[model samples]
Each structure stands twice: as C-alpha cells, then as structure tokens.
Target: MSADTQHSSQFALLRQRRFAPFFWTQFLGAGNDNLFKFAFTVLVTYQLQVSWLPGEMAGLVIGALFILPFLLFSATSGQLADKHDKATLIRGLKLLEVAVMVLAAWGFHAQQVPLLLACIFLMGLQSAVFGPVKYAYLPQHLNERELTGGNGMVEMGTFVAILLGNVAGGLLIAIPEVGARWVAWSCIGLALLGWLASLKVPASPSTDPALVINWNPVSETWRNLKLASESKSVFRSILGISWMWFVGAVFLSQFPAFAKDVLHGDEQVASLLLVVFSVGIATGSLLCETLSRRHVEIGLVPVGAIGMSVFAVDLYFASRGLGGGAAYTLAGFVERAAHWRVMIDLALLAFSAGIYSVPMYALIQLRSPASHRARIIAANNILNALFMIASAVLGGALLQLGLTIPQVFLAVGLLNVVVGFYIFLLVPEYLLRFVALIASRCIYRFKVRGDEHIPVQGAAILVANHVSFVDAILLMAASPRPIVFIMDHRIFRIPVLGWLFKLAKAIPIASQKDDPATYERAFAEAERVLRDGDLLCIFPEGAITRDGTLQEFKGGIMKILEQQPVPVVPVALQNLWGSFFSRIEQGTAMVRPFRRGLFSRVGLVAGAAVAPENVSPAGLRERVEQLLAA
Candidate 1:
C-alpha cells in the first residue's frame, strides 16, 4: 500500500462511530486518572510539610486512596455493567467523576490533603467500576479485525493521556495563587466533557441482563473471581495483567524518590521521568499493531518482558553516578539533562510495559465468554488492585530495608525475567511458533503458498481439508494471523490437545445430538467472529478424513458463509499421513512414532479465495479438493 492509502486506512478506523466514543472515554479516563494522582502525589511530596505527615506516610496514603476502591466496589460495578446498557453506565460513571472533582477542588482550596486523598480513592472506586464496562463492551462494538487496531488505539490514547496528565499536573502545581484549585476545577470540566462525550456513545446491549446482582462485596468479588479462575486461559491472563501492574506500580511509585535521592532532581525532573515512561508506553502500543501483523500476537509478551528487565537493570547502573547531595531545584535538574542513560531506561521501561499489556488485553477479550465477559473483567480489576497494592508494599519494605530505589529497579527487572520464563514454560502454546519451527527443522518439513489469498488485514473464513488432528496447529503455523478453528467439540476436550486448542482460542462445535445448544452457540460465535473481521477455519468434511479421502461436506460451512460475505480461503494439507499426532490406526490404541528429519514434505496449499456470490458449500469443497490434488 502507498503511504497515502496506508494513512487513509489508519485514519478510517478513527472515523468509525462505534469505536470513537469509547476510545475518547477511555482516553479521557486514563488522562484524568494520572492528572489527579500525579497532582496529589506532588502535593503531598513537595508542598506538604514533613511535620504534618512524614513523606513516606503521605505516599502510602496516596497509594491506599488509589487501590481501596477496587477492593470495595469492583464486584458491584461488574454486576451493574451486566445489568444495564453500558453506554449509560459509562455516562453515569463520568458524571460521578464530576462530583468527585468538586470534592477535589474543595480539598485544594482548603489545603486539606487528607480530603484530597479521599477524593482520589473515590476516583479509584469509579475506575474500578468502569473497568468491567470498558473491556466487556469492546467485543460488542468492534469486529475481530478491528479489535487489535481498536485496542492499540485505546492503549496509545491512554499512554498519551498519562503523559499529558502528568505534565499538566506538575505544571499546575507550580502555578501561583489558587493554581492548584484551578487545576481541580479544570479536571471537573474535563470530567463533564467526558460525560457529554459518553452520552453520544451508542447503546450496548447487556450480555447477561438476568445476572443476579450481588451486593456483598466480599462474597460477590470472590464469586466473580472464582468464575474467571475456572477458565485456565482467563485465569492466566489475569495473572499476566496483574504481573504487569505489579511491575508498573513498583516503577511508578519509586520514580519520585529515585529522582530526588538518586538523581538529585526536583519535582519537575521527576515528572519528566513520568513523561518519558508514558512516551515509551505510547510507542510500544502503536508498535503492537505492526508487530502482531494484526493478530492477538501472544508471542510478543515474552519479548516485551525481556526488554523491561534488561532496561530496568541498566537503570540501576545509570542511577549510581549521581553524587549524594541536597536535592536540586527545577532549573538545576534541567542543567543535568545530559544523563542520556536515564532517558533510555525510562523509555524502555515504558515501552516494554505497553508491549506486555496490549496483547494480554486482546487475548482476554478474544477468549472470554461473551455473556460473562464483564464479570471476568471485574475479576481482572480485583487482581490488578491486589497486585498493585502488593507491589507498593513490597517495594516500600525493600526500600526501608536499605535497598536503594535503583537496586529495587534492578531486583524487579531480574524477577521479571524469572516470571516471564515461568509463564512461557507453563504455557508453551503461547510459544507455539518456536516449537513449530523446531519441529519443522527436525521432523516433517512444511510449505505454505497462496498466503496472499488470505486477507492481509480483515476477517476471513478458511476451509481446509482436515488430514489429521494436528491440521489446526499446522494451519496456525502457516497462516500469518491467528485462526479460530471450528473443531468437533469432542476433540476440543482431548487431554493435552484440548489445552492447546483452548489456549489458541479455538471455537468448538458439537454434533446436534451431543449438544445442540453448544453447536448453535459455536455457530453464533463463528458468525460473531466473522462479523468482527476474524478468520474462522472449519473442515467442511466435519471430521478428519478416515481413509485419506475427503468426506461429504457439511452445511455448517454454508451457514457461516451466509452470515458474512468475507473472503473464503481454500487450504489443502498434505503428506501428514503418518505422524505421532495423526490417526494412523483407526479404532486401535496404537499411534505412529514421531516423524523426524528434514525433507519430509508437508504441503499447505492455499487456493484463490472463493467469492461468497459465486460459491456454495459444494463449490468450496470442490475447489479445496482440486487444490489438494495439485
């Protein structure tokens, strides 16, 4: 694509009505969050006297104000999101922000630091409730192809907001004569504007209107948590998101002290560090779309985690050069901007965080059950709250125990290495490409063609000849984007293979007799996927070929085609007649040995896409068969 065409395509996404409002709402929310928190932190850290409350105590108080809401209100917020129109819910939340900002203004005017803390906590509560609606609503609004781009945009916006907020908060604090009060009022105005913007958001139907509302925070939170935990992928995603927050919270919380004690810089320099970090996050988020080539791209998570660790460790060394002395004023810090290493560390830390988070969010949205998505999101919020709190406490405790802020950075960075290794080891499916490449090198070699026929950037339906059970895995390896395979529900439940499929987010379909509802739901999900611009691969023969011959095509493929006019790519898999995962012995307990050595040809042929107008199920089947024959 030419530069202008590419620019138009990118800009086209922003023009979308379904996406724009939610994008703005989230952007404004993230921006306001940082604005208030950074402002509050600056107040307590620089403006308030130590005699009123120790600096450490003030920081702890600020931390508590931010996290306490998740513990108190996340469950209720999730339940509410499921029981109402999400657009209305979001509007209501934005209005709540207006009220909270009023209190903030009062706190600023009266110089009541404690009251401002209360308002900060209230904002957190609002955000905790907003979290479920924010995530759950995406699948409803965006097509699958749009999801990645949409997510990338939202992440990019959020980081930009954080950067803006951090800059504004610091600048406002330095203003004279009711400057802090004016900042609070400006925040309130922004909140109102956000509310007005949210009102323009189209209605989002409730996924589960009949979901029982639970008022008991403890029990309800635990129930939602348990429900999400039941799905291993969802549970793991929660852990991954939590780990991100833990890592981020540690870095963000210590930045001020690191600037003051280690870099001997003033509040402006501290805020500059935040700006650099946010810039990194924005860069990384935008990079995710390009890196994944527009898929969920779980593979990037490990890569991101590694970058975070390396940069954070380097930051420790970078901080060691600062001589112990009294803190410099804002002007003094600017003169010391020659330290390029500090800039590098800040940028890398932020960039890696963006890379780590964006994919995980996409995975959760793609994998979670549509009906219970809000609850799952609520569960994620709970875990994030818990993790961030733990991060603050642990980092603070370590600092108290004589670990310098720089050392803490190094420690977290090193620990991230261990954590990343463990998660990948635990879930190798996320690292399937690496394994597939190694397998290709040692065992059966494979060839992929007509890949250009597959939509480079939109949803498609792939019809392939299923030669063996490993066909989906092979297809996934060959295709540029992730494929949501339509599999026999039975195979979807296979011990080891089942785990892998679920991780890959395959949609399982059952025979009518076995479970009619599940079968219908699978088709519905397939339709949803196509509508969202995702690729759904199905074996028209309905099951693996028993005698290495194509079975009669099923009507399910027709049903999918009828629902969406997206391109249908025909694929042919060959030469896997005898492999360990293939069924060489029908109805027998025996299996073939693992194939080894290169030059064992495995051909994956992709034919030109069959237009929806010119093709029926039979036509698609015939085309695929011909491709396979060639």
Candidate 2:
C-alpha cells in the first residue's frame, strides 16, 4: 500500500508536485469566482439600490448570469478539455480570469452595472471551461488507488475556498469607503496567484488529441448527455450528483432567510450558519478517504443520504417553533442552549451531503471512458446547473404557497428520502455495497489482506471457506470489485440477506441430488459470468459451517473452472467461528445475537490466483488454509 492511500495521508498530496499546483490553481479560481460575485451582490444590494437591480433581485440576477454560461458553454468546454492538454487550457483560463478581473476592477471603480454583469458572465464562462478539465485531469495523474482520496481533497478544498471567498468578499465590501476598491484588488490578486500556480502544473496530455471541437452548445449538450447515458452507472452517478447539488442549493440559498426569519438572528448569525455548513462539508470530505478505505466505495452514498435526511428533518423540528423575536447577535445566538440543536442539525446535514457527493464524483471519474471523460463531466455540469436552477424554482414555489422556511426544510428532507431510495434501487450496486459496508464496519471489526490479488478487471473465480452466513458480505466489502456469488439456494430464503443477495444477482445453486436442473443452471450461469469478464465467487463448502472447522472443498468449483478456465483466487474468513452468523451453538446460526459482540475481530485473507490447469479442489483448500494460518 502506498503511504498516500492511508488515512490522513491525503494531506500529503499538497506536498506532491503532480497534485499541489493543480490543487492551488483550482482553489484560487473557486475562491475568486465567489469573491467577485458576492462582492458585486453586496454592492448592488447595500451600496447602490438601482431600480432594475433591487436588493431582492440582486442575488437572483447575479446567480442567473453566472450559471447561464455553464448551460451555454459546458459541452464545448468538455470537447476542448479532451482535445488539448489540460495544463495549457488551465493556464489560458487563468489568464482569462486575470483579464476579467481587470475589467471588473474598472467596473467597480466606475460603478458600471452592465460592465459588472458582463464580468460575472465572463467569470462564469471561465469556470465552465475549467470544470471538465478539473475532473478529467485527476484520473490522468492519479491511479485508481488514489482516486478517492484525491477527489476528497479537491471537494474539501473547493467548499473551503467558497466559504473563505464569501467571507472575504462580505468583509472587504463592508469597509467604510474603499470596500469595492479592495474587492477589485483582491480579485485581481487571486487571479494572478492562480495563474502563477497554473504555471507549475505538470502537463496532462490530451486523451483524444484528434477530437473535433463542436462550438454549438445546443446539439453538443444533447450529444454529451447521450454519450454519458450510454454507461448506466456513470449516467446514474451524474444524476445522483446533480440531485445532491439540487438539495444543497435549496439549503444554501435558504440559509439567509432561514436564519433571519426562523432563527431570529442577524446577518452575523446567518454567516455563522454558513461557516458551520462549510466546515461540516469540509470535514466530511476529508473523512471519505478513511471511510472508503482508499477505494471508490459507493457504499457511503446511502449512508450519507440517511444522515442528510435525518438531520434535515431534525433541523425542521429544531427551529420550527422559534417565533418572531429580537434578532440575536452571533454570540447571543450561541448563548441560548436551545439554538445549539439547530447548529448541530445544519452541520451534520452538510457533512452528510459532503459524504454523499465525493464518491459519486469519484465513481464517474473511474467508470467513464478515458477518451470522453471530460465530455461526461461536462454533461454532469450541465445537469448540476439545471438541478440547481430547479431548486431555486422549487424553493420559491413552496414558499409562495405559504409554507414557512422550516416547512420547506421539512419538504426537502422528506423528498430526499424518496429520491435516495429511487436512485439506490435503480443502481443495486450502491445498495449492495452499503450492505457490505454495514457487515464489515458494524457487525465485525473486519480486515482484509492481499485484496490486491482480486483482479481489478477481467474474469476471476473466488473460492472461499464459508464459515458463517455473512461470509460473502465480508468478502464483498474486502474486494473493490463486485462479485457474483454462486450460493446455495437455501440461503436465498433467509429473509433480508436473501433479498439483498437477489438484488446483487447472486446465482443460487441446489444439490444435484435434490435438484439437478438448478445445479446445472448455477454452473452454467457461473461460467457465463466468467466469460463476460466479471468476478464470480463460490463458497465451495456449500453451506455455513456447523462447526468451527474448514469443510472439504467441493467439486462444483472445478466444474465451473473446467468450462471457463479463469484464474481462481483463494480466500479465507478468519476469527468468524464463534460469530452470531456462524452455527456455533446447537448447530444453529444467528440464534444468539452478538455472540461475539459487535465489531468483534474478523478477517479476510485472499491468496494469489492459481492458474486454471494447476487448480484443484484440494489445492485451493490448502491455499485457503495457508492464508487462514498465516
């Protein structure tokens, strides 16, 4: 294992030449984008009350202008990223930012509304162009093992930059006489710093150098969507991420009103709420590497969705009863013990949103074809913009219908429950991974060694000793890739586990003596799985062990291997003999819950794959035995 894959080692990426420069460049760009926009919004809202740009309309117009470019230019931007070196594109984009900032400075000095609006649109264009390159660049540089941690770092940095930028803009634009002037200077400086960082970003060569650019966004956007939709998982991930943005936009756009009306707090308290949210998301982003165990673990998605809904619902209840009262200062808000629950709810909800998003992003990066990765990401951006816009519309409609802000929160939280279930059911892989995660993290203190022996791609047959009912689940958690287990049909009737196995599409086999047709079909299906270059796992012992000993390997595995000739990997489940899932007392399993206590030690050790011709049932058994003993 590389040191960079360890917990907290994601921070070490900041010191690496390949990652640091790109990180800072993107970081500054995000910060500058928010800084410029917020300052302008503040200018229009507080400093100058133009009839065309009322305070109520300032944020809306600025936001619309900013996101408009994404809708118009994302497809073209994606093509550019695929067709040219990303480092070169990044440097050029930074230069554009510098020019935009220079113009913004002039607009601020002269108080030119049209010019400032143009600047917002121009900044948005720059961001649209950079989005595809930003995601596409990471996969080119980082290996699969580093993808999750790297994505976590970027996600964390982007949110942190956004928070800092908003804070800086609000602070500088509030200065007595020189606020706008200071904002202009800061924007320009940040642009220059981003350009400087881009200068050091190593070359990320084009994935498709011969690709033709399509300047028409209308046709290209549709084409991009179709291209992404070709891969169901990748497309669904894009949709899932877009939905997250939808939820986030709803909550974020409401913070000001939620704090002012519901919590009865001043501007300072609203800012405090934003601070908590940003920090919570950043904390959750950094935690992904550890929770995912250095892989693109989609299991965390469901877990995150649960936290998001629970906290959002609780937040509604936490602030529902607070009536109109004296506006509290930041410190005053904190002084009230009743308000702490609101803060906690907001923090945990934001944190859950963070956990929910990073994995989907990573999955998209990993699964999308390399040649069109940027275009798919562009499709994702277009979807995100649309979703966020829909969020604005939805929030407005709900509030217009006389629902209080807290009620809106309640609506979104409940809606999330529906959306989360719909998406997870559509993609059963995510649901199965969640089940595996629960098995490994909650039921057992699970550890896996030699997981690298499991093939990252192509065909492989995994033969393991079945010590307990949950052995396949623990094995699933251990391997990065999904496994199609050939399990006894009898286990398919064990209630919840059976349903999950069916969802996972595990093939069920019966003893040939009792059911010849089912037995033959199982082997044929297992063979077909290997032929299709997917992982197939078989518990050769056939059933959960009645005693704490390795049962003799069965010939069913040999029958499948004889036809498929795929590499067979040996795996052993250790320290599970006395577990609740194991038949340890009176030949019954799961009779005494917590027999080994929660998170009791358990391990999965995978040995190197044995060649097809050299493999035998006895040989595989000995290999698993060696692994268990080791």
Candidate 3:
C-alpha cells in the first residue's frame, strides 16, 4: 500500500496509476455489459413483443445467454491469464468488448434479436476471460493489508455500475423515436471508453509464463477444481462465496415479481428497490476495510451471512400483507411506513451480501498460490455459475408449486442459515474468526498496535502476557492469520471456552510436574504446528494474572525456540486485567457478569521480533513490559 492508502479511504486507490485504470476499465465493462443486456431485454419484452420470445421469458433468456460462456470458457481463460501479461489480456478483452458493442449497435439499429443475442454471449465470454485476470491482478499488485479494501472497492464499484447501467438502459430505451439508436450509441461509447481506460493500465507480469494452453474446457475446468481443492481453505471459501451468489441470485431474480405481485408497486417502485439494494451492497463493501482494521478478515463473513438471513426472513413477514390491489408509485411507496420496512430489509440483505462476498474473495486471493491463482479463481467462477443456475431453478420450482413471492423469500432465507452453518462447519476457520471478532469487537473495544511486526507467513512464536481467560481469543483477533495457542490445560476444561478452543485446534498443556505426558504431547503438537509453518502463540507468563499483575516469565517459549529457531515476537495485553473474563474479582475469573461493563477498551501491542539466539525468558519479558508501558 502507498502512504495515502495506509489508513486512508480506499478511494485513495483511484489517485494511483496502478489501480485506477484497471478499476475504470472494469467499471466500464460491467456497465456496458448490463446496459446492452437490459436495453435488449426491454426491446424484446415491451417493444418488439416477438412471438419466439415471450415477455415473461425475456429476462431469463437474456440472463442465460449472458451466463452461458462462463460455464464453457472459464478454464481456458484462467490459463490464458496465467500464460500472458494480465494488462495485455485486459486490453485485448476491452478491444473485444468494443468489437462486440459495434455488432450490438448494428443489431440494435436493425432490431435483430438473433444478432443481439449473439452479442450477449460474446460479452459474457469477454467478461469470463476478464474474471480471472481481474482477481489475479490484485494480489500481484496490492499487499495483504490492501487486499480486503481493494476487493471491497472493486465489489462496490461493480454493484454501483450494475445499478447505473440498468437505470441508464431503462431510460435510454424508454426514449421516443430513436430509442434503439440511443441504446446502440451508448453501448458503443462505453466500450470505446473501456478500451481507452485499458490503455492506461500498468503491465502486470504473468505468473506462469510458460504454461501450456488447455483447449478442453471440461478437462481443464476439472483440473482447475482439483487444483483449488488441494487447498482446503481456498476451496471451501470458494464454495462459501458461490453459496452467497446463489442466495443473491434467488433474491435478485425475484425482485421484479416481488415488487409487482408482493408490493403492488409500479416500475419506478421496482427501480427504487434496486437502487436501495445496490446502495446497501456498496455500503457494506466499503465497510469491510474499517471493520477488518486493514486485514483480510474472514470474521465479517459470518456476520454478513447472519444479517442476510435475518433481513431476508424479516422481509417475508414485512411484505406478507402488503399487496392487495393498490399500485403505488415510487413516491407513494416511500411515503408509506410499512413499505419502508420492506425497503430497509432489501437494503440490509444486499448489504449483508456485500459483506459476505468481499472477504471470501480476499481470502481466496491471499491464500491461492500465485502461479495458479487465476485458475483457482476460474474454478470459483464455474461454481458461481452453477450455484446461480441452481438458485434460479430451485426458486422457480418453489414458485411453480404456488408459493407466494414472499414465501419463496422466506424459504431461501431459511435455507441460507443451513448453508451458512454447513460451510462454516466445513471450514472451521470462518467460525473461529466469528468468535474472535465477537470477542474483539463486541465483548471488548479491542485494538492492536505494531501488528505489522507479526509475520504474514512462515513459522513464528507469539509470546504474550496472559491477563484473562479469553486472551487467546483476543490474540486471534489481533493477527490476520491463525495462531495455534499452547494454552494451560485447565482453560480447556471451561464449559464453552473449551469447546471453542477445541474447534480452533488449540493445544492444551499441563504443568510438567502434574501431568508429564500431557506436557510432552503439548510440546510435540506445538513443534508440529511451527514446523508446518504455522503461527504458534504461548502465554509465556504461564497463567492468567490473579492479582492483575504480570507473572514470572516462563522458559517454555525458549524451549520451543531452541528446536524451531524461529523469530520470537513479544506481545502485551493491556487493560484486560479487570475485565469480566480476568481473575480480578476475588481472584476468580468469570464470577461476575459485566464486571468492567461491555466494550471496555483493551489492547494488544506487539513489538519487534527477536532473533532466536537473542531470545531469553527475561529479555522477552522486558520487551512485553516495555510494550505494556507504551
């Protein structure tokens, strides 16, 4: 990240050369694609009223046409992205967009539905190729700290562009006399602009320049899926993201019917719903950077999932008695209080969608191997396409059973809960992050300083002062990566805390004198964790403070470092001594609720890493003491 982007708004990316051009190019491409598709759909459904394509099926046909290429060509596209410079691929894709728009312009002017449909497939193909390059290009440029914010901006921009494109298309096609001509010109103009913007995108070098192109879509797509599945976290995160798209597709595809039948609203009212949804997504996307504190935090995923389900289910109840016979205009809809609940529900559901998707994208980018990252993203695209198709099919089937639109909404919302839990259970990291986030953000107003001293990768030992029973949880929140805590065996016996730690795979140790076998087993597990290049944290004070004071530093950390020889980082937990989870009330922890009240300010400060040879029990304690004092 540049100095401007360190803690500043993500918009700072717009002022820089590396990101701005790419952003605009992507923005224009998405806008142009939607503009062209929406305008054509409107023409077929309202203006032409062709016998071959009925008005009711126009949107579905157009959507299917647009999504077809993703299923067929994503594998090849991912390979091309890895085999060639992304900027070059992007520029070529933009030029292809220009050509496709030129054809679309001709189709629009001639009222040639077949030609326009072909252009839709072509546009989808262009977008499909661009997808991998788009995500793969990010990790190559932005650091880990910038990934969440950068992905957030891209997601926000995409949704905003979609909204603007739909609005522009609707308005342009509604023009009198030369409406088709206007749509044609606008599409062509946007394509040209996209190509112009692509010209300024900086060169992004290929990650796998020598890779052979795989022409077989089926086989290559299978290969890509296999590649992604090799990394359990990345593969599961992909599924989580696809499931979100599934939920979103169900909600979005139902909106027109939802507004017309359920809300008894006019076209403008439907547009209002769209505007609200888009704005919500944009707001949620931008919120990730601040919520994650500039890291690729997966914790927000569960929060988003819960909010999505809650608001969606609420929307069903809110709209149950809404539609009878009164068709309300946009202004009338806003004036009604009951309708406002519906609007708020839609906005929050969309917002939760935004929050749900961005971190998963960031996590996928951060974890995927650079050499094959684009391919992994390609696998994700394939899954997304399938999940969306499933959503549409399933939603349609439910409605065909005579279910009301609001009932369909209720079903999907309820289904989301099951899906969210299933994914979280499969990928325990997500659930763990949720717990850590709740502890850090809700239970306490937690903050961290000098967190950059913690390595983003490889083996390292985090030695911290154990001030409370939940210190490990707070420590997990402090760092972007997972930490395998070597905790006292006694803490593992606590009711809910023990279960949580077991889920986190926390290694529990007893005093050597009390249980020598458990002590040795804990050391063996800790060593294995470090040897696997994972972070290992130890409360070197051996126990939580009984008197709100630091205990004598233990030599256990030095014993581990002697074998691993990894850098040892000193960490201090401040203001946690008197908290509810700490042993401050009569030297017993968790005895009284709200002992420090809620959201008490507490902090974890990490100091510079000491070389293995330079680490000692006293020296590390001094560093922790200094950090606590600071």
- TM, every model: 0.75, 0.95, 0.96
lDDT of 1 by residue, 1-630 (tens): 343423233336667677788888888888888888878787777777747666654555577569878877888888998888999899989999989998888888888877887898889988988999988888787655456666778888988998898878877876777668878887887788788789878899988888889899999999989988876666886888889888888887766667777887778888888889989998998888766655566667776887899998999888886776877776776567555688888898889988888888888887777888888889898899988888878887897898978888899989998887787766665566444444443566767766657775578888988777778877876665567888988886687778778777788888989899998999899999988777889988887766777777787877777778777888988777565655656632225454433457887889998777776878887988898888
Error of 3 at 340 (Å): 2.2
Determine which window of 10 residues in candidate 1 has minimal summed lDDT: 1-10
Residues 391-504 of candidate 3: C-alpha lDDT, one tens digit per residue: 767876786688887898899899999999999999888989999999998889998999989998889999999888888889889998989999888888899999999999
Q: After superposition, how far is residue 395 of candidate 3 from its true place, in Å?
A: 2.5
lDDT over C-alpha atoms for residue 590 of model 2: 83
Which pairs clash in the backbone of model 1?
143-532, 144-532, 459-533
Ranking by TM-score: 3, 2, 1
Q: Which ranges in model 1 have alpha carbons more than 4 Å from their true place?
A: 1-11, 50-52, 324-338, 433-474, 477-569, 572-630
So what's the TM-score on candidate 2? 0.95
In Å, residue 428's CA in model 2 sits off its true spot by: 1.7
Better of 1 and 2 by lDDT: 2
Could you list the CA RMSD of all candidates, in the order they appear? 8.6, 2.2, 1.7
